[model samples]
Target chain A: MKALVWHGKEDIRCDTVTDPEIQDPRDAIIKVTSCAICGSDLHLFHNFIPGMLPGDIMGHETMGEVVEVGSGVNGKLKKGDRVVVPFTIICGECEQCKRGNFSVCETTNRKRHLADKVFGHTTAGLFGYTHLTGGYPGGQAEYLRVPFADATHIKVPAGIPDEQLLFLSDIFPTGWQAAAQCDIEPTDTVAIWGCGPVGQMAIRSAILLGANRVIAIDCLPERLSMAEAGGATTINFETESVVERLQELTDGRGPEKCIDCVGMEAHVMPSLPDTLLDRAKQMVMAESDRPHVLREMIYVCRPGGIISVPGVYSGLSDMLPMGAFMNKGLTMRTGQTHVNRWTDDLLRRIEEGEIDPSFVITHTVPLAQGPEMYQVFRDKRESCVKVVLKP
Target chain B: MFHFSNIVRTKGDPEIVKGGPSLKQPADQLARALGWFSIGLGVVELFAPRRVTETLGMEGRETMVRAFGVREIMSGIMSLSVDKNAGLWTRVGGDGLDAAALLSGLTSDNPKKGNIALALLMVGGIAVLDYRAAQDTKPRRPPRDARRKLYPNRSGFPKGIESVRTAARQIAAHAKTHLKTHAETNEVKQGDERRVP
Candidate 1:
């Protein structure tokens, strides 16, 4: 099987690897037809989230035809089922799963200890993020072993193409989940901080859920233009200060809900001493994540409103505006998106033609071109927002 | 939220799979968490001692921070490998030492005294969580039951010649059921929807 494997920092290669077999009774093997590169994968490629071993398979956004099933899978799933596997692997029976908090499932992360030490709690196993999130082989391959098959995958309708449904695996659900966290009132104003794939999805999701105004902020013209296309008021942070522009847009009340789509690697341009300090800390290994977006959110959100963070942030250790956070009476909610929780609904939305997630797929290439595409996406070289690999 | 059952059938309603960690369980989960936290913190300290020390504005004390990192790593490994109780308790004790060290930085003339104060408070909070987890879970005996439920318990398989026959029969039965179900699924899928190979 040929798959994308991580070799080292900024190094991903297309390598021939062993096809995955069912390792547990609840597992099923999928012959992958489409897989996409995620913004989070850039963290792995850049070694931001740590704990990467050579030759580890990478990629999680995937959809495929089920080729095999383990007996424990019972009768609900079978061979030849076309499905989109959520990145978050969950045991439908866990306490968290029962409560619909499927991302922190206790049973799947074999390396919970690693995650626990850093996060102070165990995260549910992710398909291909890091050892901290269960280093299961990912789906950018010829075949993938999906755990908890019945609970963790969404069976796509027959008429849908892989491109239309593939994102039900990660970004679509993530964007929807981010918006869901905002607890948006029908008339509320929502501000999103990134224009990447997740950010774009979030903009549309907010509209779908009835936010009166969705404000999109970013430095990239392409991304900002895309946000505008989605009926958002765009702010080019390079030319305008997010604080002033947002204040103008929201009549100085700040956005009722502020979502941080840019997680660990938040960069603020035009230079603040604070931003420089954050960079220095990351450079010196003092912090693992950048908190610029989070800090700004705390300041920009309405005093009693929510700051919904969907960013995959493990930013600079222990550096936050606790004073502002406590004084303003702001509520914060964030976690890895419980993909199963939102996939079914998002799938329906897609089926209804409410949104086309594939609009974000700027480039589609063979699996072998993944290494170059990683660089292209990271450097923002070619108006790229997302990349899909076909095997 | 969607009508998955009415619309399509998956492997099973895994929520009713008769196996999951109870919402009320604890112990091993806590101890392992403490152990890994220690390792993660230690790795950061070992590789970036200057970063830790400089954050405290105790620029010249990088070596001391590295030594502390070594202790954290050892304690973490102990919590992971040795007696869970002792390992957790050791972590709690290490917390005390860390508090004292941070207090020293606070009292010292490090220009970023505010940072040192915050660091001390953070360490103090972690200490409280570690102590509680340590107290809740006793050391030594593994939480084998919880683990067994999460994974299949393979211990009861027969060891005698009967084991071979029993295992073979299980395999044969699974294959037979698979073929029947698959044939049925294929038929339904062909008529009701698109079936992908």
Candidate 2:
């Protein structure tokens, strides 16, 4: 099998690798039809996120037909079942899973001790994320071995194209959760920072969920344009003031709900001194994340409003304005998306012709070109927004 | 290294059979090598400044050497990071400073003029490499103001945004009606209880 393997920082290679085998009874092997390069994968590509080994396969957004199923899968999954494997591996029997907190399912992280040391608890194992989350070989190849496959997959209908259903594995649900956690109201204004893929999805999601207004912010013109197409009033943070524009749009009350989609690596610019400082600290290993968007969100959100974060922050962040957060009586909600919790409804929405995630995919190529696509995606070249790899 | 990584794998994880072309370009690899070289040179200049000054016959300039070392180390760190282009450019600037300093020591009074010339030649060579790496590793992203292919039609909505919003509004209206009815029923139940009492 050929897979995109992480060699080092800024180094991905399409390497021939041994095919995955079913090590556990609940495991199932799938012939991956499509996978994607996610924004979070850039964290790994930059070698910012720790725990990736030299030979680890690099991807998470994947969907395919089941080629083999272990006995423990029972009647839940069988050969020929087309399913989108959610990034988070969950054992459905766990207490967290029972509560629909699938991202923190208690049974999946094979390296729970590492996660316990770092996060104070184990998160659900994620494919190709890191050793702290299970160190599972991801689905960026011809085949993938899905652990807890019976419970960790979203079955999509056969008629839909892979591009339409691929994002159910991660970003679509991630953006959905980001918007959903805000609990958007009809009169509320939702301001989203970072118009990346997740941000783009969040824009459409806020609109669909009945927010009175959705404002998308980014430095990239193309991304801002996409957000505009998604019914969001776009703000180019490079050219204008996000805080000022958002306030202007909201009649000076500040947006009622704020979403931070730019996580660890906020764009470093001279205009944003905090971002520069965060980048400096990050380079020195003093901080694990750049919380510029977090700071901005807290400072600009309406008093008594909600702050929803679906961004991937690895570890510690510095200089957060807890004073503003506390004084404003804000409620902050954040987590990895329990993808399975929302996929069924989202799938129904997709089937019912409400939304099509494929709109975000601006690039599609063979799996062999996955390495170069990582560079293109990271650099945002060719106006690249989303990349899907066909295996 | 792949074999070493394999040691950490559990029973059924895939192992690398044969590696293929890497995403890292030649210039990127060159930048990496230069970064390590910068760090190594910086470490020496910082810790053994006296030795460097003695070799170049520029004694009593240890402080200046140490400052250069710090600059080199910072550049090296940046070069080794995702911002390697910046690091390489900094190295190029540092190379100019290095050449000027060495030229200052090229007078007849200096006993180690030969050593200074050799050092100058090395700096000149490294400068070229740094310049090349800096140019090659520059981000391929278009300029912020560059005209781009805009996506004004990709609403992600199959049914248009208006329809989705209208449907959501209807749902909200229904929910409001249901809540109003429930509240009215509660008020009536309270009234009945008070009358009975």
Candidate 3:
């Protein structure tokens, strides 16, 4: 089998690798039919991620057909069932799972995914990226060994397009989580920072959840326009102060909920070197330069509002105002999205035509072109909201 | 609720009108035991404050501190358990630790032991009150919310003690996570028992 390998900083290549097998009874080996690069994958491409090393598998978002299941595997899922595997590998019955925090499951990716030669250190568990999460191999390859399959893999309901369902692996549910964190009250207004695929979905979710108004912020005309089409009031942060526009729109109360879809790679003027993580995050979302938008998210939200941050923050960075957050009584919720929680609902919405998230998927590349497509993504030339790689 | 007066206050004169034994003896014992506990805690904190802080996360600090504050109040009640002549009173005061100080301490380059030592000192302050309360007669039980505060309160300390008990169980559960991090590393060799496989 072959996988898209992350060789080093800004370095990724398609390489031949060992075929995956069922290493555990609860495991299932799947033949990946499609996969997409996640924003966090770009975090791996840049040096912001600590544990990932050269030649580690690249993509986390996947849709595939199960070819084998381990001996003790239950749930009655068969070998030929088409499924969407969630990005986070989780054991269904762990203490974390019991608390509904499935992303940080106790029995998820226990095996080191990245090859030993990549990094000198081992990590807790995560698919394909590296340690920091257990380094289990990822799905950007011909075959993917999925541990805790019953807990992490969701069957694609019949009638859904493979392209539309691919996102169920990450963005669809992540976008839903960002929206869910708003804890929307029917009359509330929401401001979403960034208008990439996830941000677009968040706007859709906010509307679906009955928000009175939705505001989308970003610099790109294409994404901003998409947001407008989706019924969101668009704000080009490059042209106007996001906080000002939001206050003016909300009659000085600010939006009830604010979300940071742009993570560390936020766009800001006179950028700092340390904020490269912010920039890298932007590039993953297919943006080039931006200051950290999380700060703006804080400045623009109402005093007693919620800030839902689903953007990936690897390790820790500086510059959040804890005192202000405390003084304002703002409730901020974050961490990796527990996609399993929202996958079923999101898929149903997609099926019902209540949403057409597939519009955000602007590029489709063959598996072999994964490397070149990444460059197109890096250059921000295609206005790519998402790039699906067909295997 | 039992009536509180200057007699239970333990004012300027160490030797008041009359009681079984002085508050000094148990106060001193608790102080000594606290010193030992402080050293052990300091060792843990000194070596791994980041581990503790990370597990505490953003909202956890306030919750943990409130819990510890309640535990301290309980310790004050437990102190009444020690000295019959001693009295129990809950001290409810101002905002405890500033966020800047909390962040600074959390991300500090200070020796782990020193951080633990400081935490122990805070822990000791409450332990002393607990020890003293143990020695006193069955004092009035305070309400849950009132007793755990470090400052003054209208409702007595018994309820505060129960709050501490609940908070302690929560804190203990959180504390076990830190221990598990180490325990997992040590057990990695023989254990293929990892839930994910």
The local lDDT score (0 to 100) that residue A233 gets in candidate 1 is 87
Per-residue CA lDDT of model 3 for A91-168, tens digit only, reads 778778777787766666454344233333332245776655765667887788887777778898767778778888
| Candidate 2 ranges beyond 4 A from true positions | B184-197
Q: Kindly give the stretch of ten consecutive residues in candidate 2 chain A with the minimal lDDT sum.
A: A276-285
Report the lDDT tens digits of candidate 3 across residue range B4-44: 21233212211112111112344445443543443444354
Error of 1 at B101 (Å): 40
Off-target runs (Cα >4 Å) in candidate 1 are A268-270, A315-318, B1-197
Per-residue lDDT tens digits for candidate 2, residues B2-115, read 788777677678988898987767998899999999999999999999999999999999999999999999899889988888889999999999999899889999999999
How do all models score by TM-score? 0.67, 0.97, 0.62
Of the two candidates 1 and 3, the one with more favorable lDDT, higher being better, is 1
By TM-score, who's the top model here?
2
Model 3 chain B is weakest, by summed lDDT over 10 consecutive residues, at B13-22
Off by over 4 Å in 3: A111-124, A271-291, B1-197
Ordered from best to worst TM-score, the candidate numbers read: 2, 1, 3
Error of 3 at B90 (Å): 64
Q: How is the predicted docking of candidate 3 categorized under the CAPRI scheme?
A: incorrect
